[model samples]
Target: MRDDAPHTSNVPYLPRRSVHLDFHTSPLITPIAQQFDPQEFADRFARLGVDSVTLFAKCHHGQLYYDTDRAERHPGLGGVDLLRSQIDALRPLGIRTPIYISVLFDEHAATTHPEWVCVDEEGGPVRVDSHGVPGWHVLDMTSGYRSYLAEQVTDVLGHFPDADGFFYDICFDQLSSSATARAAAIEAGFDPDSPAGRLDAAAAVSHDYMGRLRDMVAGDGHDGVPRSVFFNSRPRLRLADELGFSTHDEIEALPTGGWGYAYAPSVARSVIPIQPRAIGMTGRFFGSWGDSASIHPAAALQYESLQMVSLGLGICIGDSLPPAGRSHEAVTARLADTFARVQAVQECATGAQRVAEVAVMRAPITGGEGVIHADAPGAGELAALRLLTSRGIDFDFIGPGDDLAGYRAVIVLSGVGIDDGVVRSLTLHVESGGALVLSGLPDDVASLQPLTGLSSADVDGFAREFVRPNAAATGLPDFDFVLPGAVRRVRAEGDVHTLATVTEPYFDRTPDRFSGHEYTPAGAATAYPAIVARERVATAAFGLFEAYGATGVPEIGDLAAATLEAVFPRPALRIDGAAHLEGTLGRRSGSSIVHLLSYLPSRRSSADIETVVDPVPALDVAVRVRLDDRSPRAVRTLEGVELPFSVEDGYVHFTVSFDDGHCLVVVEEE
Candidate 1:
């Protein structure tokens, strides 16, 4: 498939503005949904511009919200049938209602049937945390819980035939040493006794059940339309392998909930190339789920929502419905305002594809664990997100499965393992005149020596070093710049140009030999090259990406950007603006949209929470878009205000400004 082509599937239409309502009611709570007024509830969502709502069918508490004879309903619900009522209320108002089901963490099941609990290799039951604390227990899917889950799902399907889709939560593999798991592993041709074998077997079992559940959902449709199926909590790194079990991708990244703000954009960029129709899920609370009364700032919501839509992704704001089923007034108000802003730019963002000329290989996960969180933003990935986006360089996070032919440049950050397939693809890319940039050497550096033109690449025995750009290097100071990270020593063979040299520190910081408070200062310049280039391939001795992520160093970004520009001079998009501004270019058949967002988040309190409190000031931004031979018929904002532009050397140049933290400009073809 072409990189820009839409990922067409039989899934239901994805709503731009949606809500994931959590209703994990405890059995002790009485009179659930007692205050729920169907018309009022549906009206509020419609007024907020919400087109879809995911209501809970079964929650982690193992309480069914709908009327079912095969399972236990929340004791507080009485005869309310919360899920049915929610669907009936919203469906008539032209709102899509998707059902949510908890797959692994079921409190009631774990407490009632001890045999159904998942067991670790150490013979300990798997759970969220200590048993003394209040947390959900994981149930073994290979055990009897599988039948119970399937029966409950079938019941939901039969009852809510009009539902638009299904969202399965906690759909990750678990390492288990149970009898059923061992037997299933053996049947699947895997040895259960080996740790690697057990991990593989667990993933196989999870994938099998997910596929079966997806088929079941697909088989039962609403009229002639197919229902969307998404297995939440699956790792983004393995999306290529698990895409078969999902109809649409929904990234559940609550920034305040342990996932930093960079996680969503990194994951979204990676996902949209594979599945254009995807949702970026964030939460309305200040922290994570279960924070009922707490509300995030309106500015924060606007920043997140605008950024998501700018990337051509649907927006889903996560929320927890209180026991009385009343909406949080303050939170809903902020959401209503944010949704209005999103609706305003829907015209420019609706069908446009992300225009990227650079592909950065995402860093591999630590430990190579089978059951990993969906959003694993490594230091390199986070730096890539910061550097690329801030520089207004449109790019995408790629994996081994992605085709490198579509991009003009491919960047392999440090810490990303290079497998045979990746090596082959990158070699082909470089041979075809595409730019190839690499950071510090990975474990498989020997395999790429010929391509990199490096006679030797080894780690220098220095904890910290400095980079000194040569006189020929542009946009870099002549003085040495501190690189507070591990440095690698490299020697280029024949026909290679040295961009920068290494400046070694006096000594490694020891308890007794430390020079300063932190580490030693730079001592002397070494002949070993810090940055080198052969043809279109550029190599860095240290991980500029990693250093930038670990420490907010402006010099690192500048050097990285300069190196990239040296090799990949003509990018798809470039914006000259403040570092606070992030830009993305989106293109359709005849027009292109340029999205500009500016927001600075800071630590608000003593806690680690970061929030945006001030509005962005107005500033003009100069932009250059590579349109090749095409001429612009019109250049205007989404509001139709025309702007003057000129095309020079294959780039269409224009300037735009905004004061409300987000701006979108449209360029039409003649």
Candidate 2:
């Protein structure tokens, strides 16, 4: 294990409110810096409560915004140093301005030196089209473009000596199918076309480039003034050890933009622990980044900002500067409204450590393939997160190799196959009195049988089945028929108790045996166990979470919650609120903060966009926090309103009227 100490930044400050300004300009949009008034821009940012902003030093078109001696300035902007002017204006206002430099897609560099462009196996330049715009050719870092990029970065640093950090964009893996890349791979003893080989080669090249960049930036810092470095992609992977913060441009254009509302939260939750400082970048475009005139609703921005803070992540709202260089007042006002709310909650959330009782373990794929089992872990994990957060379960999304000792329970999502090391760790955790919940058919079930007390013979069927609770299943009703997606039959033995049994349908819905629309009618329950439970471990054969995530089935979540309650027995915090209300718990300096966020979107049915409406009044919501030996001294909202509460059964209970889209409850302990 390598020490991660050097990767941590010594920078003393982190801004909760920040903006990522996009300035990817084209020749058609000339006079790039004409409308950009430094004072007006600084004033707008100050009014919006922005403490940090990333100004573009070089755009994807490979045009320099500043008066760079090494690189050509944009032909549209002859002599205006837009980057220098913005930094000069904002720095005096106590704002940290980072320089944004496009690393991969540099059109000017690719055009000027065609040999430096990334080429495919056919010896042709690789180009990518984005958002109906003709894609620019990406530069190959292994070529002389690497030296040019370094010189450009060094020039920017020299010009802006007081700059805050560097934001490297489009620095992910660029798979080269080019003959040159193939020859290089062959020299390095790897197949150019193999997925693993290509991935490894790309990783090596990226590592070298990022390492050189970090060294150059670090070497430039003097007198305890550290310059932060962050890459756009792979924030949690290869470059995490070298970067200052983990960042993902989660431009979640909900309802339409391909990314549903659940994607950003899942990514935020998973990446927060990987880096000491994690920031989520979301754009304000109505559709996405390129929509210049489109403005995201204020309410939606508010919800997104609050969600990021609650997940222990800094929020960076994305906005593209208009070609005229003038900041949009309407967008600034909308962002101001959201930033004010973010500023209020961040006072308590800042420096707070997340308190999670459950850690969801993401398993590796089977067959030694270094790939995720599904596309983005699928909806099963997302639905599980939705259900758990709605129920006020304090949980964290953890990946492989993350420490599991801190959590009281662990959930292995459906379809994830565990390796031997993970199996051993999980078995040890179970033996040490930790709760374990296994969903779906894990590939390494044979190794987990001792902990689960159930051995799988084979998958019996793949039809629609219902799960009816047995008479012995306490806290769960027998009438609940959960439609678990794919049924896997397991043989219960050695103190393993069957909590529920699978009720098979009349017949499989074949071409000839079809009943009505979807599947055949349900029949009586069978002897096979749908859910099996032991002392510290509970295993389910059905892909219940997958079904629930795909269909939003309440029965599946209900069964899962009940089973978890039975197994874990006591969770850290419990909240009685609407399903749309989500809660996150954290502690800082002897006090606990509970962040309650509302998910009531305005346009729920619109597939084009999601907008947040007025906040729903959640009255008389009871929140119970289990305090082992500490006594509650005071309970109040973030706005300092005292809330009435009581203590019983070693837990503090409080009822709050959450009227806003976000509410924070601070519990002072004695």
Candidate 3:
């Protein structure tokens, strides 16, 4: 994280480090793991703008990807030094590679020397039937297994200092049956026949055992890279550090109806004022909501998600590797490509000149739309914010009014619970000539009542997701209107410009922890409308709008693409449809690389579908850039080279294309 650039007020914009791949992922595509092809991989990422990767899976395991004396070949598996070749190839691509070590999952060593494994609840060793393996013993970690683990971790790290750091996975099961059973074993005096007492020893062994190993990792002489633990629930921050860990990651991979990658930037960022270390969000079990869809790698949501993390929101994107230790080559390629873009962003951000002269925007509610919806208890706002950010729209920040004059627009989220003062400030933003938009008011009024022109009153229902392509909109027929009276006519553009409208209102419960109110059954919806506009460049970005993310395509109060750009007028980037893929920004040679990734064989799985048995068959990408801001530029495609630009509304547009499952394109000023 070192840089030669002098710090500035904008230094907060500096990029932070990120490693998307985690060790515990379940790869449906059979992750591409072969005779490590470093050069080819490096070249792939070089195009993407990434240069660092945290080798989480087989990188640090005692078992080798291929046969090697340095480690044991996992039982019934061939070996491959995927890490070594990847790292070696990456060096030339100017990428940093790191490995994750699960000192806990050394099946070979742990099972062979059960003494080194963790004990059960009572103080005796934990015993698992190994799923179907009837006699395989669960290694006991509590009973003096420190040396064994340290050696394993150190050895793995020692092999690759060039790696960014270590991503520790599933080592501490603070809330697993294993811990419960171990506790019982301890009370039973390690008595196997003690009925319920069968786990006390195992629990104590696990708890104390992990603690000791943690100390050794910190105190041990041979220091590997800084370590980060996965979804560690051991509450105290100091405790995590004492155990040789620097990062306590957010939860990753839990079923949220299948939203791929289990982290929400909006929720995470909203909590930053309270806890800074809650920087990362990790979700392993992803469940798709009937409404939400996969991310488009070329879209702003991707950028916003990363930016939210960059702006003090650490991110943890996790996936499970195949049991066979293989990763889908296509998936890996997409990862590498996006990693490059993210790396570039981070590099540019961290090493930039900071100048503290800009304005910020608050999420806006135009016309009849008012305060935004309250956050659901478990669903954080970080993801929502990221969705906005990924669109490249700069949002209004929360701070002193001194910065207000610096901003051109002030959006108001008119929800049932908005404090009165905000309503007053919003009244002023509109009166001052700023553009606005709204969602989920009433259809009774033919025109927008307040907020900004970002909305319209004709009240067509919400529009279909652009990714799916819908020319018509289907929104809430009508709803109760909650006008605070503080808002009035912000502007009258005539037919020349119509009031814009966001999609339908969404309902959700606030995170059980952050709110003071009792949970209510009615639930809260994004009652507010969205607004958008361009602000001063250095001081702030143009385009600000409130959005109730896709609870379902074209919701009653959700934001729409056409309306979004209408109110904002200016945007960092624009897209045509909803995406079948996800993307991110990266760097390979310390430059910006924008990644657009989609799993190959993209057979549509409605967010409701669970397991990913196959990937999308075709996930190509095509972005039109403003290269030189004038002349037309050509991007290559399977169809053939095509012009990606045309003079439209006084701006030059160029296309950068990626196609069929996975693709990427980098844009550097010519």
Candidate 4:
């Protein structure tokens, strides 16, 4: 199948203002439908500008909210067909309703059928505990639970014929240590204890279960039209090829949650290649999901939602209904303010493609097969991203499977082992006049010697070393001491030139040869070249990006940025603004849109929440867009404020005052 093939028939109907309503109720809760007025709820959503909503059919407690024959309804519910009422109320308003089903963390199913629970390595059921509440055990997909899930999904689809789609929650491959799991593993001809065997077994079971769920939904949709299906797993590198347009939940509880502020932007950028049409899912709570009393500020919610749109992603705001089934009026009001801004940009953002000149290629996790072993960003890659973002450089994260010909330059981070596929693609890119800025040389540098213009020699590394720029290094200052993680000595051949040199310390910092504090001072500059550049390829022997990210050394980041500028002198777009001002470019048909976002959040205390104060004062900014041969007919903001612009040397230059937290500049071509 083609990479851009349509995954579902309902792709055109996917909405920007989608809400994921959480209904995970407990058995002790009563009067579940006391305040559940279907008309009022639907009207509230419509007032909030919501075009799509995901209502819960079944929650994690295995409690069915609706009256079902295949599954038991919640004991706390008062015999109300809540799901049918919701679908009926929302269908007439042109609001698409997608049914949500918790597949793995079904408490009732696990308690009734212990054989279906996944067994961990310690021979115990896989259980989760969340925020002082005892969590439910996970169900093994390879067991009879798979069939039960299929039946539950089929029952829902049969009942709600007008449902827009299905959102499968908590669906993952768990490592099973049960007798049945081991038997299946042995039958697959592998040792049950091995990691590869466990991965293969889990992948196979998950794939089969997902396929079954898809088939059931496809067979029972409205009027022979198959609804769209999405699974909830972010950073799904291993299963991207199998999954379609899904929701990526980057549960970033800003300052204090597990995901930091940078997590969403990084993960969202990386995920675009796998699922281009993916939607970003964040919560309205101050902390995380299921936090009933915690509500985020409207400003915070607006920033998060706009961040998603700026990165070419749709937005889904997550909210949880109380046991009384009453929607919070305060929350709805805040959501209204946030969604209004989303509606303003939805027309330009939808179906638009990101315009990036630099593609920062992530190192292959498992050689070239693209099987994910680790999903976290590497030290060097994270550092490069931070540097680029701080300097107002537009870039995107790409994988081995992504096409590199569209980018003007590609930066390969440290420790990326290039396989045959990557070598072929990079070679073709360079031959087409695209520049390459590689941090470290690949293992098989011999194959790429012609492009790199250097031959590998004896590699010399220090526990801590400094980098000093040579006379040829313009726009870079000579550093007295800067940390470059590792260094490999290379002999320049043909027309290669050394840009910088590595300086070694007096002695290696061992317990016996330790200096006064950290390490000995830098002694003499070595003959080994720190950075080398050929005709098109520039290679840095040291792990400059990774070390700078890990250490946050100002010198390291400055040197790295300088070297990047030297490699790609004239980027497609350049922005001159504050460090916190973020800009991204996107193209929709004959026009280009530049999204400028100013991040000005105040840290009141050491708490995890970021409070948004008044908007910062407008900053003087200049944007230069290289149009090649095309000429711009007009340059203006989305609000129709014309900006003064001039064309010089095949580039369109303009200046704007950025004040309103967010602004979009449209460049229409003639």
Candidate 5:
């Protein structure tokens, strides 16, 4: 589990990544108006740069996506051999094929082997879906579902030896097995009087079931590769690691809203590195009334996915398959284009140059937008975290009076905004080889002046606006490149842009609401930072790119890349994210690539659409493009492009021009 060597595990999510898609036809899928052509669909995937596709299946339909050593056929739909053509067609495209098997629901298995069905205390069978509606039915993880699943997957994999891999969707073992059994036991008086006792017992049972399933599939590497397990929304991804499983999935919101986008940044930050080599990451942007990351370039998708990759996480892009049929031409074309860009990210990034050893663990709270407020970041962000587990970064949501020591960095996201102590802790951390990146209203910077040996006599903090980090000004490198354009200027020393102002919204301002506070941002800080970091380094350190990134030239010149490369050429962990889509970027052993989800632009299309998003987007993001920098250039985004930029004092100010109601600007050091 050390960074010096490869961490051995059963799950592997790299090179040939898998995705989930819908089915056109299935033997037991009842009757429907839409029928998708397997060949056409397979060919379509090949064109879209997809390596694998899956079916949201319940029964082992006779169309035979999986071979049956068991029962027989259902005329017309029997032995269609859909996997064969897909395997054959995908080969030339360099795509590996993988199939997804729904573990919990199988109308066939339920009917054929009724005993396998979990029975309630009332002696009734568990029901997951009643009248075709999605609902939870706690199943028995300790039962025959293990062998049945193994047999089903094994049979499917055996049928198509050419299949690239298998992605297990709806991990029934975790929730169905653990949570249900615990809830049921509590109700049945299995220590129901004690909540802690009930939870402990349930977890023990859940852990046992998952461990068994993992042991059954411990990487013989047959049928392309073993099954890739996605433990849905569970923070304890280590459960998968302990079970010899690798890979995890999460739904994140678009940045501008930032690392706090939907989910807590610390939550994603906490688990990303534990097993990043083949770690799985995913998210839903949600609430994109209409906007793209680029000029109709699936902006949201590109933004979120890229950020994840830079953070050293693999991506499993997710989206709902059309309710009617196979993908529409527009959907397919955009996907192809989006994935191609991801490939480019993989190409441009290499070595440890973009991957930094996560010396700190910082995860702020989620929900409630605006300046510092206690309840803004949720309780989920406050869990205890083990940063040392991930070879790189480690983060946990900060709680009231939480002791933060023994870390080189302490990251605070959009949780409670710029708290005086949080600022002091980061300053102390930086003073001791630590670094910090506080995304969103970073008014706490003013609090650091006292610790950094600076006078904060004229500091006036606001949220919104922007400011840039400086290696020379602050003697910090990690934060050098993350500059804010229109900061609130919370503090001021003569003409210098000190800590910026960020107002805590009335919604985010419930000091006493910490207990009953359903975090709601009701006020606003003067200016909020989209991205912020606290950096430290000696002035003798040359070729420092962070401070020089805004200069549009390598700080140490080309020599930085050649002479004393390790020293001059600083290595970093690039947490890449774009708006629109969700995914991850990670490096294990030296090979680094950006795995991504295809960005879904607004269903409505228009030209030159632009909008202003209050909070800066979260997740790590890097935009690759050629900017016409005759002035401070507003770099182009999937939402749209801007041609002008501004430079004033030590700040770089600019507005993003996009038709989709979003704007972004960077204020890197010059």
Candidate 6:
């Protein structure tokens, strides 16, 4: 195990370079693993710099790859223990093999035992594919499928006692209306008829199942070797509640595979704090899993892998094995190049710790109604990340329960529910000299009076309004710009500074009152304030974060950046470059490593394929790092090239040039 490898109590260390091989062979397919030469398989993976490979024990097609009597084996395997053979081959080569098992979406279990199928609210079987489509069906985890899965797991454990670990897939909320689930919900004192109650019941089942599975794997038979455990398909945002179930996080965000370029960074930032020993999973396919023919461009793979390592996390490239069990030449070759790039900067990224200056609340603090819950990142959370990233501002996502003392500013997005606890936290943060930025109107304005220094008034009673930035509003146009969302009117009390004011239109665009072809022009400037700031706290009456996400208006992001600046003027780290050049700062040992990524994805075809063909043009980058009073011993690239530098105002200022997709700069402090 390397020093840079991610580790947990159960799993002491995980390989930095791993591969997730998906082998979901249908029962009808012929000669599964028949052509699989153990040596060839091992040689290919070892050649590609893979230290760990997740092999399949069972797949969504409901067929086991290994020789098993308790479950239906893949007919194509012809009584071959494919799983065991692969492990036998890889283990001797010093490669760890984590066996994968499908949990909920099992076609065999659902087809043969229809009684175990998950029932949806409409009394129909819950499924991933629509009617007449050929795909796996969802099974009720609280039904007989629970015992069935447990039995299969026991069988696997009994056979391969020395297996490296287990990777559980499709472990998420399988909300059900089945009799068993309904009865369990009732026994747990929840109204199964309600959507919220049903969701809660489902979450409880998932949590319990996860605990049982974890205990079973950790139970006696490991031969003293610690085994890793992970559950895929669970929402990353909600992992805070279920951290006990897994040893590490395998974030599966295939950028070109529908999880866009922004998804990986946003998810990694949120999940890394809780589970630092994590790996970012991206597929080799340009599209997604099972798209074997259309491979990812070499540039895309390099960008994805470098981005993951840059964040102080390991990288895993996903690939699928053909039924004949031979590795694809093209995929193998491309991966070799990508892995080499990762190895180039492996030393610099080894022990780096990301430095975040601001904490963006994932959900608003609620009084008791509970904060927002979603299977994906909330609009405000994702949008806020994009805004900050574009401006070269570093941040992390935090829940209400997370500590705020380490952060310089806290951003509360729109559409969040507020409670007294939230109000107290914000108030304390502001009073302690920390900054607070509220995106939109909360349910109750009076609750935040201490922070906002304003009282609840009335709505602006207009469909839309224009914002005119005063001199106090820095970096904004003095002229009016369209503010495109609902604005909550508030009366400024005490000593509050108005950064911008609202200008209402002459009249509503009614049938009788016609203006230009579109919205009415700005007519009168009102006393209402669009932005207000009071002693380390600022409020944007409109849902700027949410609006910016929904509509990528340039003015909206500009306003957000300026508002953040007004509250927290001195960020810990600042970078001056093209907006597309994403910067990530981290500390390791006696130095800090700054990762600059400069690859821009392009949609080349009508099918919406995001590909990166060429490296970015030569970019001149300037970085300002706050070292306080300590002087910099040296500033150099990871390749050991010393660069010219200067010090001023307790900060080290340096400049470097990089045209490559990724660049690593190390700053040594004395």
User: Model 1 over residues 318-418: C-alpha lDDT tens digits?
Assistant: 88898998887777788889888888887556678877878998665433443324456677777778888876777788865578878889888886777
Error of 3 at 320 (Å): 8.3
Per-residue lDDT over 89-141 for candidate 3, one digit per residue giving the tens place of the 0 to 100 score: 66665455545565455556654565655554456644444323543234445
Question: Which scores better on TM-score, 1 or 2?
Answer: 1
Better of 5 and 6 by lDDT: 6
Tell me the tens digit of each residue's lDDT in model 5 across 1-670. Answer: 0112232444443542334453423444433314446567667766655444444322222123433545522223344444454456456665544455555555455666666566653567777543247433444554565566666555654565444445544443222224445465665456633655544454555556455545544443333345454433223423333534433344333333223333334445444344344433332223221121222236555554555545544344543344234456765665666566555444444342222333332343332222112222232132212111111122333342345564434433333444666655555666665544332233334454443322323443322122223334333332212121222333222322222223343332246643234433324433332222222411111112221222333322221112112111122211223323333323334233222332333223343223222223333333221122323224333323333544444223333223321222222221
Predicted candidate 3, C-alpha RMSD: 13.7
Q: Sorted on lDDT, highest at the top, how do the candidates line up? A: 1, 6, 4, 2, 5, 3
lDDT values, one for every candidate: 0.81, 0.74, 0.37, 0.74, 0.38, 0.80
Candidate 6 global CA lDDT score: 0.80
What TM-score against the true fold does each predicted structure earn? Answer: 0.92, 0.90, 0.42, 0.91, 0.52, 0.92
Off by over 4 Å in 1: 1-11, 120-124, 129-133, 186-194, 366-374, 417-423, 442-451, 457-463, 484-486, 493-495, 508-514
Q: Candidates sorted by TM-score, descending order?
A: 6, 1, 4, 2, 5, 3
Candidate 2 TM-score to native? 0.90
Question: Which is the winner by TM-score between candidate 1 and candidate 6?
Answer: 6
Q: Residue 361 CA error for candidate 6 (Å)?
A: 1.4
Candidate 6 Cα misplacement greater than 4 A, ranges = 1-12, 121-123, 130-134, 219-223, 364-374, 457-459, 471-473, 493-495, 511-514, 608-611
**How do the residues 579-635 of candidate 6 rate in per-residue lDDT, one tens digit apiece?**
677777888778888888888898999976687776685366888888886788999
Write down the worst ten-residue block by lDDT for model 4. 366-375
Q: What are the per-model C-alpha RMSD values against the true structure?
A: 3.5, 4.3, 13.7, 3.9, 13.3, 3.2
- Sliding window of 10 residues with minimal summed lDDT for model 6: 365-374
**Global fold similarity of model 6 (TM-score):** 0.92
